[model samples]
Target: MDRSEKTVLTNMCMIYDDDGNVLVQDRRDSDWGGITFPGGHVEKGESFTDAVIREVYEETGLTIETPQICGIKQWPEDDGSRYIVLFYKTSHFAGELKSSEEGEVYWTKLSRLKDLPLARGMELMLRVFLEDEVGEYYIYEEDGEWKHVLK
Candidate 1:
């Protein structure tokens, strides 16, 4: 069996408030509707930290302080393509929230995050972030069922 090549990537800013509420967005484009965090693909030559800061600023108009890595999610597609997404968290930021090509932004209370519609993988990831300590690394399969490879 041939294992698919994996693309290592970073998604920074599970932006949180002092109270621990996370920031979520509603994608304006059909390609990415519903609830999601503010982030995107890391550009070449750009560090993961820098990518997240830039993405957050572009998507939500917020300038985030350096984010701390929280978790890792692996999405392996059937077409032999895989995306290893690095998740980060940050509570320090500045600027007003605004809409962008990415989506409309909102700060969601951690307790109510599940009440909102979110990407399939997000619900589980959020739980891990809340229940666990400050930092951790987890690997998940792309299947609807999230299988953890690390704690």
Candidate 2:
């Protein structure tokens, strides 16, 4: 990696209901557009937590608070660029649902998640967040290959 290389910082949030269903987005215009969660890039000077809240409001027309930092997912590209996706989870939020330019927002039961089309690596991140054993870890990749653990 060189000084000119960049690491992009983004955030993702998984909001669930009492019955274990989660808020999901059926994306049609994004790279990983499919059945995904609410989230986007963290703007300049914005904290990761605040970014998730802002994203939730912008993408779902809802106001959420105290989203717990669950995990981090990173992928290094062949062009020397890197992406850091911060994952969060919240069972609390308030507002009405609204269609977003990003995608069609709705809820899907956890039991049925496997039956839907998921964004690339969505299952990995979801597993990392939902399972306690995985707690926090980072994935280092190059040319679309997982090169084993770094630590």
Candidate 3:
């Protein structure tokens, strides 16, 4: 029997400033609409780090430096394909902050994140990004019920 499966690669970055604020994008897309980090698909032939850097710049107009991979968020699609999101964080960046077609980008205090309307599953994803012990956030099915985990 064949056991190979297709996968999709994507990324997201949590950019921080000296003032304890993090950059967030108020996404306009309906699929995962609401507040989230700036990121996008990893193009074919692009390295994970490179893809995230390009994505951050395209969506936020700021070029990030030395982005560190913190964790991963993944889930299986209905068609049997898997979707994975590489999570990154960085404090070194340059360029004037500007919003792109994807959304309005701005800096907000980390403490205020809980007050805003976040994208679906974003709250759980944050656990992997912020907690040192959590390396992966994912969803799976068992006994016909879906379950989420942070490991």
On lDDT, the candidate that comes out on top is 3
lDDT of 3 by residue, 78-123 (tens): 9999999999999999999999999999999998987899998889
Q: Over the full model, what C-alpha lDDT does candidate 1 score relative to the true structure?
A: 0.76
List RMSD in Å for every model shown: 3.7, 2.8, 1.2
> Candidate 1: lDDT of 90?
81
- Model 1 lDDT per residue over 105-146, tens place: 888797888888886556667754665652444545555685
Once fitted onto the true fold, the runs of candidate 2 whose alpha carbons sit more than 4 angstroms away are 1-5, 136-151
The Cα local distance difference test for each model comes to 0.76, 0.83, 0.94
Best by TM-score: 3
Query: How does residue 92 of candidate 2 score in lDDT?
Result: 92
Higher-ranked by TM-score: 1 or 2: 2
Worst lDDT 10-window in candidate 3? 120-129
How do the predictions measure up, each by TM-score? 0.79, 0.87, 0.96
Candidate 2, run of 10 with poorest lDDT: 142-151
> Deviation in angstroms for 127 in model 2?
0.4
What value of lDDT does candidate 2 attain over all alpha carbons? Answer: 0.83
Clashing residue pairs found in predicted model 3: none
Give lDDT tens digits, candidate 2, residues 1-151: 6467687999889999899799998887656678888899999999888899999999999888889988777877677788888889999999998869999999889889878998876776677778876754466756967763322
